[model samples]
Target chain A: MNGVRTIFGREIASYFTSLFAYLIAAAVLLITGILFINNIGRSQDQVAPNPAAIPDFFAFALIFFAPLLTMRLLAEERREGTLELLLTSPTSDSSIVIGKFAGAWAYYTIILAITFVYQVILLNISQGQTDLAHALCAYIGIWLYGGACLAVGMVFSAATDNQIVAAFLASAALFLLWIGDRVGEVIPNINVARFIRELTLQSHYASSFAVGLLRAEDIVFFAGIIAVMLFITIRLVESNRWR
Target chain B: MIEVKDLSKRYGDRLAVNAISFKAQPGEIVGLLGPNGAGKTTTMRMLTGFMPPTSGSAAIGGFDVVEDSFEARSRVGYLPERVPLYPDMTTEGYVTFWAKLRGVRQPAQAARAVLERLHLDDRSKTLVRNLSKGMRQRLGLAQALVHNPPVIILDEPTIGIDPQQVIEVRETIAALRQSHTVLISTHILSEAEQICDRVIIINQGKIVAQGKPGDLRKKLNAANLESVFLQMVNKDKRA
Candidate 1:
């Protein structure tokens, strides 16, 4: 929709203009780069290096970076009272939510794209022995996983007017999702543990694209999370009119 | 044309707007006069489709705000009390963004035209954050008028601006009377008396009186517009 595109354009422009976007990108890249160097540079002599190490580190870093990137998406608008203008416009609530979510996702994808240099570095370090197929799957998997995290952050951002509160809530939610499988490990019942593990983001990533094994169910899992989070965000933003 | 019928808003147990109804004829400037918290903003919000009414209805250009929200909203432009703006954007970019959102055919041209009308063309490239409060207020008006909508709702458009800016904004609103159906809310009774063709006085979320400023003054037997407004609001409080 035209409204969506307009909002998306404004959002992306604002993100680039603000210091928040650059700060998050710098931090994510710095930490991820360090982790990449530490892992691949230090583990060269191993018989079979774990190809999943860099992607795993990237995913873990996104749990924090995604929230930082998205915390201001809606919360800042609400605080500045721009949400009133946006809502009062002809634009639909879903369009606003989707535009904002898509804007953040697109920015996150750019950050992820920059991290591909780490992949190239890995390829060179492995002396052409790096599993390019596995690396490709990891890239796809991490991108989707990052999208899901950004959507989750958007939901929290829509829930509150305070950026700090939005950031804290989104980070807490992402942290829980990241560690859900470990929590599942300590559960007493086999069925409950399996269900919790299946719900965990790590489980979905590790079993499928994290290891070059792409499954329809895993892709669906990430898509489903994105859809549900964005849906909830739309509902929350819509309720602002009534409240 | 803008029409509202028994529009009400409730926040928990408190009613922000209590079945208030009125209409602004095509190309007429009507002022909503109310004290702070007297529900002028809430009513405007409902009419603009920013907020749904707890009951009743509002329509703009024959489009119902509740049932035909997008259409109704497209026909109306609202300037909120706080002059909402994206501080990072230039004046031109901000107005253009709103114009595009409102579905203008040529957003850039519309934005420039509105800025020119408001005498803001010279500062179009200035970031909103760096502008004076008065300039920001004018930018707010620029965005509201960029789409050339038939109905305009402005809530306290000149609240915090300087006296000169207030006059400029008032003049701008007066200029709009020939082309747009405008509803302006303000607690400043003199401002309403000077500009509004018809003024609606609300107290405690209900319309206390509404008519031409002079007719209301004559009926209330008050010496001036301010006295009439005070007498009405105070009389309601006494009751």
Candidate 2:
């Protein structure tokens, strides 16, 4: 739809024009680059070397970085008062939410793609002994993990006008999803604890795809969270008129 | 054409708009005049379908603003109290984006014509953040007019603009009187007196007076609408 394209275009344009995108990109890339050079660079193993380590490192890093990237998706517009212009237009609420999600997802994908150079360099020097499929699988997991984190961050962004509050709330939310299984283990009902564990970020993505096993259900879980978060977000914005 | 009957908005217990009712037909420019905190913005928001009325109904071209919000909104253009804009976007980009969001066919052409009509052609490529307050106000007006909607609700369109820009904007609005029904809110009594065909004066969320500006002035036995407004509110306080 033209509405989707228009909103998504503006949202993506802002990511390039605003400093938040650059900050997140710089921070994530800097930390990842440092890890690539320090921990993975000094390895020569054919099995458990840099290829194996970089994916795990980036996956963990994205769990922390994606929230920072998505913290201002909608919250900053409310804070700056631009949400009024968007809301008063003839566009539907779902279009706005989907547009925003697509834009943020595209930006994070770009950032993730650039980090592929690290994999290339490690491959080039190692005579192509690296398991590309394994790395690809972890990359997919990271993308899905980032997507889920972005959805959670977007929900927090919609709940408030303060960017700092949104950021912290998103961070706190992702942290809970990251550790839900660990926290659930101490409970009385073991089945309930295992179900709660299955709901965590690491349990869902890393346990399966960390070793490059691509399960349809794991992919569905991340996509499902994104869909649900956006649904709730659209409903929240629509309710503002009534409230 | 617009009609609002017993429209009210209450935020938790404090009433913002209290059973206000009015109507304005096609080819009319109605001024919503009120002091600060008089629910002028709230009323405009309800009419534009940005906010729902607590109790009562608003119909724009016979479409209910609440029940038929999307259909009602499709025919209306709203400029909120503060011009909320993406500062990073150029004037042209901002207008085109708004037009497309409002479902304008070929938004690029609409944006170009609207900018030219608003006398913003020279600054079309300039970022909105770099624009002056007057230019930003014009940009806001340009976005509101981009879709060529039937009804235009402008909340304090002239607020904080320089005198020269105010005259330019007033002239622009007066020119728009040929096609679209305009609802303008302003605290500036003289500007409203010059531009509005009918004026609704609200005080404390209730309509205290309504008539042509000149008629209201003559009825209150005052020199201008400001003096008449003061007398009406003063009389209400004493009663």
Candidate 3:
């Protein structure tokens, strides 16, 4: 537990001091802010606004932003040879993986929190018509979704020593997960298509939590993904000892 | 104390370290001398528990490096050839991070002590990226010593540093022999002759000779340690 805390503290401090983290945060905020404004303008000319607009935008942006935040978590250590020091220490491989994953997840959560300013603005503009319960659910949903994406990014980071290669591979994997449902729509068989759609990240968010409905299955899906990715990351890191 | 028996490492059909065995008594400074690709780093990695040996075993402080890795690793401190440091962190921050990782109760105090010992106290707050090559080498030593382990393994500690820094590092290693069992790998024969109490000369993944430097010199009928080493390695090459 002490090892975990030490690694987590150091990793989080590195993220705060690095230029890459700040650049990713700024880009996410700017893009999400623009999306919110566009959604609000459309809402004024139509019926009640879709409460899922901001949450949906945040989730979509995470496919890019999460990789940017997590690409350096392990890859940089390997490239600079610091991975040797960490591995030779008395700390367990699991603690190192979990600590690094938690650090990246915490940074992503901070960026997610910043977007809530847009939510407060929306609450005031909607004049109490916005369902506060639905907004809160969307925030919880996006937070879990972002955690899952970051875990995937961390797995790729552990697989390579090059940060750019890690980022590219993670982005490709996240892009596939994002578009899985759309690809499923073109499948000819109904049962197979439904199975593929159910596996897509978009379907889980759109059907359950994006519109304020929280299902146990959707929560399980995100949690299970995070667990599996982190497990794979641990294995990847442990393989260094054998090599 | 350190012990090894028939340790071997094979990297995909190529034997990087052939079956070899040696030992270092407590308070001894042993030099692992070899040419490039002579398996010096591989042997050190096995001893430190950074990597597992393919066919043999090693123990540090009487704990097996593989079966009792955690305890063995806790007893050893290693500085790799290329000093691994987080460039963004200050010297103090970097050393403290390592001290904390090793479960030091007072990490800040331990970090300060190690830095002072390495003559890096004045640059404690300087970023690692901004440090000169000599300072970085000292910081690397500081990180390895922060845990205050009973055994220390250093791989080519003076490979790329300036001559003055090399002298400073050699003195530090010599001083460590008073309390710690030290195993250092080097290709420089003079370094081994100057600092090592005993030298084990390896070539092509095998130990060709092992003994006191002075004894080897007298036995081989060589003018100096370098000629003795060249004769041994040259003999291996001819065979």
lDDT of all the models against the reference?
0.89, 0.85, 0.91
Judged by lDDT relative to the true structure, which candidate is superior, 1 or 2? 1
Ranking by DockQ: 1, 3, 2
Q: For residue B164, give model 3's deviation from the true position in Å.
A: 1.0
Q: Write the per-residue lDDT of candidate 2 for residues A1-243, one digit (tens) a residue.
A: 676888889888988988867987888788778888775545734335545465577556665677676777788788766777677677777888889988988898898888888878877866797777777788888888888888888888888878788888888877778778586557888888888878887788767788778899999999989899999889877776766
Q: Where does the lowest 10-residue lDDT sum fall in candidate 3 chain A?
A: A46-55
**Model 3: docking quality category:** high
In every candidate, how many clashes are there?
Answer: 0, 0, 0
Sorted by lDDT (best first), the order is: 3, 1, 2
| TM-score of model number 2 | 0.93
DockQ of 1: 0.86
Q: Chain A only: list TM-scores of all candidates.
A: 0.95, 0.91, 0.96
* Tens-digit lDDT string for candidate 1 (A82-164): 99999989999999999888898888888888888877877887798878788789888988998999999999999999999
Top-TM-score structure, candidate number: 3
In terms of lDDT, which candidate is strongest?
A: 3
**Model 2 misplaced stretches (Cα beyond 4 Å):** A37-43, A50-52, A120-128, A181-193
Model 2's chain B yields a TM-score of 0.98
lDDT of 3 by residue, A1-243 (tens): 988999999989998898977888888889888888887888889766666677798778777888888899899898899999899999999999999988988887888888888778888988887777887888889889989999999999999999999999999998888888786568888888888888877778877898899899999999999999999999999898777
Best by DockQ: 1
> Which candidate, 1 or 2, would have the higher DockQ against the true structure?
1
